[model samples]
Target chain A: MTSAPALVPRPLARARPLVEPALREAVDRLHPWLARIVGYSFGWCAADGSPSATPGGKGIRCALALLAAEAAGGAARDAVPAAVAVELVHGFSLVHDDIMDGDELRRSRPTVWKAYGTGPAVLAGDAMLTVAMATAARTGSRAALGELVGALDWLVRGQAEDLAFESRAFTGPDAVTVEEYLAMASGKTGALLGCAAAMGAALAGARGEAVTAYRDFGRHLGVAFQAIDDVLSVFGDPHRTGKPAGGDLTSGKKTLPVLEALAASTPASSRLARLLLERPLAEGQLTEAALLIDRAGGRRRTEAWAHIHHQRALHALHSAAPLPCPKADLTEVAAHLLHRTA
Target chain B: MTSAPALVPRPLARARPLVEPALREAVDRLHPWLARIVGYSFGWCAADGSPSATPGGKGIRCALALLAAEAAGGAARDAVPAAVAVELVHGFSLVHDDIMDGDELRRSRPTVWKAYGTGPAVLAGDAMLTVAMATAARTGSRAALGELVGALDWLVRGQAEDLAFESRAFTGPDAVTVEEYLAMASGKTGALLGCAAAMGAALAGARGEAVTAYRDFGRHLGVAFQAIDDVLSVFGDPHRTGKPAGGDLTSGKKTLPVLEALAASTPASSRLARLLLERPLAEGQLTEAALLIDRAGGRRRTEAWAHIHHQRALHALHSAAPLPCPKADLTEVAAHLLHRTA
Candidate 1:
C-alpha cells in the first residue's frame, strides 16, 4: 500500500506550476457567469464564487503533455497551451457527463449542474469546449489541432455509448461484452490522453512514427488508469476516493469488474447479476455484490487486464525512444497513476 | 413583399446540392443514435428515425461560403468543405439553443430536445460541433481553423448573455439595452456568418485584406438577417413563419424590437412595459403587446436598423472586389435575405 504522499510524482509536481497559470488565464476568457461555474469545476472557487479549500484534479494529463514535449526534444513550456486545452476539454466532459448521468456530486462537492442550473451548466460546458478549441488553435500546429478534434469526437461518442449502456440488461445477448467495454473505455478515456501526448509531441516538432508511438503509449496508459479507477471506486476507502463505496454498483454503471463478474457462471456471479438489476441497491446488497465479484475472480481479472495494458504502454514508450531523463520521469508518473489508491 | 420562391436565392440553390451530401456524410460518422437525433435536427428524419416531410434550414450560410470562395478567385467547389462545416456548426447551435431557450419547436417540427430527450439532444449537438471542427481542420488551413474557433467562442458568449438577460428586469436599470442587444446579436449570429465567409476565402487561398472584407460583409449581413427575424417573430404570419405570432414576446426574449420598445418613453411603451413584466402572457395580451411596440415606433426603428446593416454589408462586399458574376449573385442574395417576409 503506497502512502498518500507518494502519489504526487515528481513530474506532476514540476508540471503543475507551469500548467496552472496558463489554465487559469484561458478560463478567465469565458463569460463572467460561465467562468464562475467553470471555476467551481476546477476547485478554484466555491458555488458562491469564494475561494475553495478542496484541491482540483491531479493534473495527470498536463504532466503527460509536458513530459511528452520534453521527450520529443522540445522544452516543456512549448506544450503549455496543449496542456491547458486538454484540461479544459476534460473539465467540459465532466460537467456535461454529470448532467447526463444525473449525478449530484463530484470531487466531494456538488456537480456543476447541481450547483448551477442545468441550462447554465450546459452553457458552461459549451464555453469551456469553445475556449479549448481556441486555445489549441493558438498553438498554430495543424497536426496537433487535428489530434485534439479527433480525440474530442471520440470522447463524445464514448460518452454517448456509456449512457446508452446503462439501460441495457445485465444478463442476456443484449448484455455489454468485455470487448465492447474496452472499446468504450478507449474512446472515453484513452482518446484524450492519446491526444494530449500526440499534441505535445506534435507541438515539439516531432513527426510521423515517433508521435504515433507516443500516442499509442498514452492510449494504453489511459486504459490502465481507468481500470485502476474502476477498482478503487468499489474497493478503496470512501474518504480517499471521495465517493461512497460501491457507488458505481448502486448507480448501475457497467464497469469492467461487473461485466467480468457476469461472464463468470458461478452461483455467486449469478446472484451478483441479479442484485445489480434491482438497482438502488441497499448498502448491504452492494457489499454482497462486491464480495461476489471478488469471489467470482472479477477483481483479479480486472487487475490483470490493467497489468496487460501497462505492459503494452511500456513497450510503446520504448518504441518512442524518448530522451533519457524525461523517459525516466514518465515511467515514474505512469507507475504512480497505476498504483494510486484513489 | 418578396415571395417564398424568391427567398431561395440563386447561390443558395446551387450550394445546397453540393453541401447537403457532404453534410450527410459528415453526420454519418457519428454514433448511430446521435446521427438519428442530428438528422432530426436537419429535418431529414422524424423522432422515431423515419424520414420527414419538413424542409430544413435555408442554407444561407452555405451559400455565403461558396460565393465568397468564388469571389476570392477560387472555384465554388473549392469551398465545399467550408460550406459543410459552417452548416454543421449552424445546426449545432440551433440544437443547443432550443434547449437553452426551452423552445419546443423549430422549422415547424418538434425541436431536437423536445423530440428526443434533452440528454440525447445535448450529445447530438456535441457530435455536430465535433464534426464541424474536424471538417474545418481537414481543410489543412490554420487561418480557417482559427476563424471557425473564434466564431464558436463568440457564439457561446452570445448565448450566455442572452440567457442571462432573461432574468433581468424589463424596466429597471438592469433592463437589457439596445447597444447590449446589438452586441449580443452580433455574437449570437454575426460571428458564425463572418466565420463562414472568412473560412471560404481562406480556403480559396485568399490573403489578408480580401478575407477580412468578406468577413466584414457576412458579419453585417448576419446582423441584418437577425433584425429581420426579430420583427418576423413579432408580426409575421404563423403559417409562413412556422411559429406563433408574437412568440418572442410570449417567451420573454429580449430581441432588438423589444429592446427598442423598452427604450422608448411613450404612453404605449409604458403600458407595454407593464404588460411584459407579467410573463406567459395571454394570447390577447401578446397581440396587444405587439401593437404597443409598433405604436411606440419599435417596428420602424428595428427595420431601420436592418436597413442600416444592409447598406453596411453591401459596402463591405463591394470593397472585397469579388469577380463580377459572384458579386452580382451575392448582392442579389443579400437583398433577398434582408427583404424576405418570412
Candidate 2:
C-alpha cells in the first residue's frame, strides 16, 4: 500500500481562487428538488423564491469532508452526500441559532425568521435537520450514519450548554476560560467537522489509522477556524466582516478575547464584571468595554492563541499520511478558513 | 408455535384495583433514577421533589406498550425500557402542550411551568425528551431503536402541525374535518403508542405477522384513548378529570367531537363555527358552547366513535397469534384502558 504523502504547500495565488468555484459546483449537484428548498433558505434565492445563483461561503466543511475521504484513497464523489449532510446540518444550526440569538441579519441579508415568520422559519430549520439525517442514513455507510448521529448528539449538547450559560446569573471568569470555550466549541463546531472528515474517510474505505489521522486533522482545523472567528468578532473590519464592530461584546457573548480580557485584567476587572452584571450595557458602555478589552491586551492574546491553533492544524495535516490531489486541496481549504475575513 | 390467547370475560371488579398497583410498580421499576426528576416535574411528587405516592392517572401508554409486547410474546422485563420511554415521551409532550395551551393545572396540581419558571420547565421537558431517546437507544434492539426514532420524528411532525394549526387565520370549517383531526392525533398520540407496542414486540423477538398485529392493536388503542380523552375534555367532571368542563371546546383545540359536530351540523353549524372562531370565550360562552355541542348531538356521536375504536382494539388483540400468560394480561390491560374514567 502507498503511504500518505507529506503535506505540500501550494502556491497561494493559484490555489486560493479555485475554492469558491469548486464549492459552488459541489452544492449545485445536490438533489435538485431538495436543493430548491435548501438553496432558497440559504439565501441563494430571492423573496419571491427565485434562484439567485450567488454562491454562499467557501464550503470549508464540505472541502474537509472530501479531502479526508480522498486522502484515504477514496473517490471524492463517494463523500458528496456526507459533505452535503454536514453543510445542511450547519445551515440548520445557523437558522436556529440566529433565532435564539435574536440576530436580524446573516451574510448581509435578512435572516430566515426576519424574512419569514418564526413558525415557518422553525419548520424550515426542522426540515433541514430532517433532510440532513435522511441523506446520511440513506447514502452514508452504517458506520458513517452512526458517527453522524453521535455528532448531532454532541451538537445538541453543545447548544444546550451554550443556552444554559447565557441564562446564568453569574458565570465565573474561569467558566468562560479558553479551555472551557474550546471544549464547548469542540462540541458545538468541532464535532460536525470531525464527523465530516471521518465520514469521508469511512466512505473511501480507509482503514483504521488513516481515518483517525484525518479526524484529528479536521478537529484541529475546526478549532483553528473558531479561533479565527473569535478574532474577527472583535477586530475585523465591519465592511469586510459584514457585521458591526464589537458585535460579540455588545451582545454580551463571551468570545475568546472577552474571556481572555477578564482572566488577565488587574484589580480593575471586578469593576468591569460589576458593570456587566448590573444591567444590559448601553451603546457607550460597549465602546468602553471594547477599550477595556484592548487595554487588557486581549486582542494580542487571542490572536496569539489563534495563531498557535493554526500552526497546530497545519502540523496535524503534515503528520497525516500523504493524501492524493483532492485530499491535498484540504490544506488549502484550511488556510482559507484560518485567514478568511468574512 | 402456540397461538395468542383469546380474551376471557373476566369481572372488571377483580382487575380494577390491581391496575394502579401494577402501573405504579412498573413505573417504579423502570426509571429508578430519571423517574424522580420526571415525577417531580409531572406532579407525581411534592414541591420539595419528594415522591408523593399520589396516584397517577390511567398509565394508558405504559400499559399499552407492555401489553403489545406481551401479545407479541416478548418478556415483560425486556420491554420495560420501551414502556418507560413511551411514558416519558408522552409526559414530555403533555408538559410542553400544557405550557402552550396556557393550562394552569394538571392532575389537580400546578403545571410544571406554573410551579417552575418557563425556562426551567422547558429544560425539564427537553431533559425528559433526551432521557427518552437515550433510553430507547440503550435498551432496545436496532430495529426497535429505528422504530423509536421514526416515532419521535412523527411526534415532532405532529407538534409542528399542531403549532401550525394554532396560528392559522382560517381553517375552513372543511379544514377541521375528522380525517384531518385523526391524522393529527395519530402523529401526536398514536405514533408513540405504536412505537411502544412495536418496540415491545421487537424485544420479544416477534417478527412478521405478530409484530404487525401488535402494532395495529396499539394504534387502535391510541385512537380509542384519544377519543375518550376528547370526550372527557368536554363533558367529564371537572373534579375527577382535573380540567375545566368544555376544556377542549374553550381552548378551541378542535377535538374529534368538535370536528364531528361541525361536519354533521346543518347551516346552523356556522353559528357553532363562529363560537369556535371567537375563542377564549367570555363568562357564559363556555356554557353556551357546551349546550350548542349537545344540541348538535356531538357528545353521543363522539362516544360512538370511541366505542368503535375500542372494539377495533379488542378485535386486533383477539386476531393476534396466541402467546401464554402475557397475552392474557394484555387483554385485561386493554379492557381497563377502554373503560377508564380518569
Who wins the TM-score comparison? 1
What would the TM-scores of all predictions be? 0.97, 0.79
What does each candidate score in C-alpha RMSD?
Answer: 1.7, 7.1
Alpha carbon lDDT at B188, candidate 2: 77
User: After superposition, which runs of candidate 1 have C-alpha atoms over 4 Å from their true positions?
Assistant: A1-5, B1-7
Question: After aligning candidate 1 to the native by TM-score, how far in Å is the CA of B177 from where it should be?
Answer: 0.7
> Where is model 2 more than 4 Å wrong at Cα?
A1-41, A44-58, A109-135, A138-142, A167-175, A207-213, A237-245, A266-279, A311-322, B1-59, B84-88, B95-140, B167-174, B242-247, B266-270, B322-324
lDDT of 1 by residue, A12-62 (tens): 889878999989998888889888899999999999999886789888889
**Candidate 2 lDDT, B1-342, residue by residue in tens:** 122224323422333243334334433432233344457655568766676866554565565665566667655566777776676777777766766667788888787767764434444454455456556655526666666666766666666666656554324643756776677677777788777778778777877566666667777777777777887787678887887777767667777777777776645355677887788887488777776776676766777776777678667667777475656766666655556565
Docking class of 1: medium
